[model samples]
Target: MASTTDTKNYKFNHSMIRVKDPKASIKFYEHLGMSLLKKLPFPDAKFDLYFLGYDAPQSVSHGKEIWDREGLVELTHNYGSEADPNYKVNNGNRDPDRGFGHTCISVDNLQAACQRIEDAGYKFQKKLSDGRMKQIAFVLDPDEYWVEVIGQKSVEETEGVTTTDPATYRMNHTMIRVKDAEKSLKFYQEVMGMSLYRTNENEKAGFNLYFLGYPGEKGVPQGYQADREGILELTWNYGTEKDEKFSYYDGNSKDSEGRQGFGHICISVDNIEAACKRFEESGVTWKKKLTDGRMKNIAFVLDPDGYWIEVVQNERFSGKPNF
Candidate 1:
């Protein structure tokens, strides 16, 4: 359990996923107007990490690195995954095996964006016209990962706040399915220090969506999840908790058959050692300890639903200044 004071410097940094082709994936997000802020290539390891996000409210050429910002999508590309035709990454949205849901990119005009994407020959998992949720659409990236396209104007209209400025193309939130909503909520709220932004129930569909966000410089806004960055959306299907046979493959287990697509969500902290120590004392399940395996400083703690939360000390806490 992280004490209230322990959360002062904690920030939800990024959600990572393995990509088959970096070029295609980067182009996909680039089309959505997300700038490739940084690309860290590990030549010896034959892998790379591409951080993508928006420079909202600032000029397009604003100089903010990944750590200095929030709501980043870390696309990890392992060499040769693109070349191997036999390699197929699981989409995690299907039945039986499911966990990490999708990363949403909120746009201003849903119709225009979907048409533009269609014009580019991109595939959509769920088109705006294909589902009951007409306000949103799910288009697939090169690797088949869903990039949910929602409307910022929809939010503004719902909130009854008219804005004339261009309001679109921002990373809204990342979604992951959980078995037990209450258990996951406790882990994220009490243990993780995230505020419940909102909750919506589809009683007919038999599920509920919970939006939680760690307070950024502006703090969690008193608005819709679509209006905020670095938000984590947890989806719970009704009656899954009582079903003893129910389970979700968290995308990290080795025995799971398929490419480990959805890696983990990272949390930047002030002191990793102290944070992990508290997690240890709280009887939290450990995926990787700070002192475990061959990796040091990089730690992963498990939530109730078996999703991994990677922990790392932020650069600001390590004596480097962002500004």
Candidate 2:
């Protein structure tokens, strides 16, 4: 269990992924009803950060400015990745080594959403009829990154043909592949102070899905598992632990070829300095400490499987309520 102090201070903010073509990537997300909230360009760095989210009616007038940062997907585009032959970015399709999994979007009508995607000429990695678990489906974006589509209603409600209201769709969760379920679960629960909201096991598929989020008075309501925004889904595939050769690629790290893809997940802390001290005392490995980088207010910690968790001060990201 996470300590009360840690529980009170943490909020899951966003997950980032690298994209080769900003135009295509942005188009794909927009098709799913996510508006391009903001774009932060770093000409010196030769990259740009594009933040996309589902804008509520109140914030729609901001026009590319994201007042509510919850459930935002940060798309990092390296300027030369698409044009320069020497540049490489991981789309996660090269191999199982690409550890980053799919991000999810919840829709009021799953059938209609899937149809819209198909009508728009996007391919489905897993169709509604293609899987034993028909409640969810997977669609591939232009980058070939998987995007899971979940419905608001039960499987029974969506058994037949349905109509989709794109306006009701919103970014829900980001999934990451984990090697050891127990170890990752402990890290999220104890270190990050997130509650295990839900779990789904597929014996036939040889995998398990564990959803974790901050819950209670200061967090999301316990019953809001399906409708919650910005949840983290950890996927643990069985037998990966026993096989020493089996290792999922950390999208943030470089292989011999210098390819990178998915970046770290950000967690806003009420007191970043104090949180870092607690993490260090708990024996958590630091990837980039506040003192190490120029950005002294932010820090990064590594999970058991080497996935980076970025910790930033909540005050620095003021706008809407924290998760």
Candidate 3:
């Protein structure tokens, strides 16, 4: 029997979002402690790209850092006559809401993190992470997309834990658009047992937002204890019909069938059998189950909303207690 922490195959790369202003967005993350990594300018493409992370320089002895570099968040600014497939470009129409999709980061101090962000002259949409005794703040880039920050030390400060690793990128949190924020909130909180950290009905902004997570976990798993960087972002357009299929350009689309949209999310567990059993006991259904196949010992499950999620007993990092 494997425990939830036994699955070590779980990993989150980065959540990609479309931004109208790249430089401003870059400054937003920089304010949260992320450094500018590599910036790629597509001269032929009229788009500027930037990558930011909180890791030290690479070592000479090791070829390339595997699971030991700083966590990273990528931002791309596209300049052109591009149109959001789902949204019509009308001058009369207002801008999309700030919650369309957002990213969250872990910081050293919850209050300090929020203060720092507020000090930067940015408008915060949500309070610091306090509901769960963690510092979490929500602010938006110039494009109106929200980015959250959580105190990294909280997880590390837990009873006993130390998050140290260059590759240990704390990739936590995932938010997506739903037909009804209330319904989605209830689904996660009531069904999944996640505590509703915070939510907003920003009619003035043309949308609503909600953030939920495991209510009492000292910190999310992977690295840095609790004081890590990043969160999952979700965006749901208000008073809009659920599209049969949406787009997945990291812009404004959630096409389930198309290549674009919120892809499946993964959760690592120590014991795949027990984790799957817990979900089954809780009434969650499986989309794919572990079996003899290409990715052995892996299974997929779906939330009530039809979004896919992966549950696995990561066999790679089998040495750690909650890896």
Candidate 4:
């Protein structure tokens, strides 16, 4: 258990995904109004990290400081993933067993955004009119990664009509598939101090969707999951727990084939030392502890199902605010 001083709040920073072609991936997100906030290259590590965000005025100067922006996408490009013709980034579409799911972007006008995406010569996995869920659609990126498109309004309001608004667009949430819903839920709730904001269990569909968020004292009000930002969606297939060997492919894992697709989810904490101490006391699995890496301020903790969760000091990325 964390001491009173060690109990600090956490904010979702970014979700990373491995990209085959940086140019194409960046273009795809740019088409959706995400600007490249910063690009950090680790020559020794043989990889580069590109951070992209939704909203930024010209007056706002962004670099590493843009970490303060919620819902940012970090595209990780290995040294030769693009140059090697045989290398492939698992987008989860081809392999249903992959752990990473789709990342969502909320737009003021779902129809207009879909049209824009279509006009840009992109194809949709599920169009607005194609499914019973009219308000939501799925667009595929260059790597065949699913990007869920959601409208700002409720499903009832988006009935059969195209809404258009250019100004409203932002990163929403990243969904991940979990083998054991109960175990994963316990890790997130007990270890990370997150709250279960919403849950949707579809018996007919044979699955359950759980949305978790770090809502502080001001808890989430009823029926606000759709609008709530920076939430993580855990998709649990009803009977995966029955099979002892059943497990989803974590993008960060490697087995001579190369690194998997999706990278990790990052959370910013108030104090890195305290957080690390707490995690140690809780017996959470550590991928990269603060003392293990050159970047001493950042650490990576693995959830129950082996998904990497990055924990970092808030000030290290965003910097301390000026009083």
Candidate 5:
């Protein structure tokens, strides 16, 4: 099995989005009461970045609080200019046939967010409607990128907002696009030692669910058995042909912006230093050394499909050290 590097506890962190103008995007989200959590200057890329959340609005009073109490939406302004206000933010190049879609962020009140964004005059490719199990709706970000709002939080957030316990919001799952189901199954299962969780293997829809994680010798519950942390969801479309190798900034890849399908996933651990060392030793040092501290000791690594996987060591995973 490929070494996962000694990870602390695994929890769901945040999702990253590429943008032409972070300021404009932040303004749009701020109108809806999202607070800017952190900002980073990527001098190499000649860009400024920001992370926004739904817990608080931007204000002098609320701005004094350093600790954000909710999930976040990261916005990256590329080091360039843009003539068009409506920029293309979908990652359709990775899987052209699948149509670049929007990233879905879990919310407490799906209907309320939809109403608020709708009132703010944001366009929507789809309206707020019923889901198979929950409520969902779509809205365009300031850059014309589609987004989905769901009424669910990360599995680790057992309690509602305002809770700082790291154990509450563990990284739930990640979705990826693969060319072949059988091939991915072998790579993630045989190579990664992930079990085949609930999957839609039927070729009709051409989607299968393969879960990758470290589980206890004896199975317990759905998300409880994984001692190593959370799970990685490998999504493969059995019918369509997708780019085997895609670039996040290539701009020609089908899913370049991760708007259509589920975007990149971030997993938070207790020991990021050890994880980087292990990933380095495993011949997979794609983004070694984490290079950035804006996300609080975070590092980025990509999987087989070039999808970004972030590893971090937040305070939440400091519980009983399994290592």
Candidate 6:
């Protein structure tokens, strides 16, 4: 289990993905009700970071630093990546590299939300009417990353609503494929100290989903799963764990045969040193230590599937400068 001391303070913060054009990416997310919270530029590093997120429940600040909120999306634009004609980022959804599936946004009116995206000239991976599952629709971003649009209610009830407004929209979850269900469950449950709130299985489709997150008191009743935040959805395809030749791309590593487009998910901790010490004794794999690179305040640890989970704190260790 995660160290009981600081684990309670650790919360899922944001998921990062690389984009070719920050302008186009920002426009896309803005259309989906996300506000650009702040932009961090690293001129020396030749890159910029754009943090976007929806307003947290009862939040007074319409705009605040994204790192202060939970469940934000970080769009990384490396300088001149847009100008490179030969640069092709693997979206991590194609053949032999199918690992990260999609990030979800729950809407009160699924039909209206899908119509808005389609009418905006954006591409759709799966329409509401597409496939056996008509309840959820998949829209593609500029990078062709899937953004799943799910409904707040059952399909029949959702479609019956006449209002065109998707009144409540929240960044629900980010889905990733894992090899072993049991092992993955153990890691997220015990090690990360997240609660497995719900599970869904498709017996004929040969897969199961486990939704894990930290629960809190929103003004609204937390009875619905859609109301919660910072959820991690793990997809376990039956038999992949036993297959000796099968593995998903870590998404941040260049060592994989496929190029990486998706980055890491971040979790905020109270004290970086205490968190690192507990993780070390637990034998968690380290992608980058707190002091390994130029960024001394953050660390990266690998999950069982090699996906990087970034560990960070809001302020410096000395508490002089607050981020």
Judged by lDDT against the true structure, how good is candidate 5? 0.50
lDDT string for model 4 (1-323, tens) is 22332333677778999898999999999888788878989899999989887654521123435544457899998888788888877775455457888999887667777988998999899998896888789999888889999977766665556655433576778999999999999988888877888899999999999998777445663775545456799999999988898888878667335547888999877666777888899999999999995787679999988889988766643356311
State TM-scores per candidate: 0.89, 0.86, 0.46, 0.88, 0.60, 0.90
Per-residue lDDT of candidate 1, residues 1-323 (tens digit): 23323675677888998888899999988887777888888889899989888865552224654674568889998899889987767677766578889999876666777777888899999997886777888999988888898886664353433332222466878899999999999999888878888898999989999998777666666765555677899999999999988888787664256457788998887777787777777789888887788668688988988888988777666666322
Off by over 4 Å in 3: 1-10, 56-71, 80-100, 129-135, 153-171, 177-225, 228-250, 253-323
What's the true lDDT of residue 279 in model 3?
A: 69
Clashing pairs in 6: none
Q: Rate the local accuracy (lDDT) of all candidates.
A: 0.78, 0.78, 0.49, 0.78, 0.50, 0.78
Q: Which candidate do you rate higher for TM-score, 2 or 6?
A: 6
Candidate 3: Cα lDDT at 178? 66
TM-score of 5: 0.60
Please, what are the lDDT tens digits per residue for candidate 6 over residues 165-220?
Answer: 53357788889999999988998877776778888999998999999875533432
Alpha-carbon RMSD, each predicted model: 3.9, 4.1, 10.7, 3.7, 8.7, 3.3
**Total clashes, candidate 5?**
28
- The TM-score leader among the candidates is 6
Please give the range of 10 consecutive residues that has the lowest summed lDDT in model 5.
163-172
Q: How many backbone clashes does candidate 3 have?
A: 47
